[model samples]
Target: MFALGCLALIVLPLLGFIAGLVMGGQGAGLWGAGIGLIAALLMSATAALALVKAGRKR
Candidate 1:
């Protein structure tokens, strides 16, 4: 999950922008950017959660 999250943080925005531009135009690209940002945030949060949950025992 951590690896997936890390990869997604980079891929989501790039793919979103390209896909939006291809599908529509600048306006759609903006929308894609917003959506990608939100998705990235969620994925990163998951990565953080994983780190906390994987901590060494006391």
Candidate 2:
């Protein structure tokens, strides 16, 4: 589960960045990429915290 979350943390934002590039231009794409990266980092951090909490409970 944690591994999958980590994979999602990489893949999801990459997809978003590519989509942004295709749909928009350089500026929009850059902005989208930045947003995607930030979102991914936040998501990954949250997932990591959750996993750690669960492990501690166990």
Best by TM-score: 1
lDDT tens digits by residue: candidate 2, 1-58: 5676678778877777787888897776777778877877887788889988988984
Best by lDDT: 1
lDDT of 1: 0.84
lDDT of 2: 0.78
In model 1, where do residues sit more than 4 Å from their true spots?
1-3, 56-58
Residue pairs clashing, model 2: none
TM-score of each: 0.75, 0.70
Q: Could you tell me which 10 consecutive residues in candidate 1 have the lowest summed lDDT? A: 49-58
lDDT of all predictions, in order shown?
0.84, 0.78
Candidate 1 lDDT, tens digit per residue, 1-58? 7878888888898788888888999888878877887898899998888789889546
Which residue runs does candidate 2 get wrong by more than 4 Å?
Answer: none
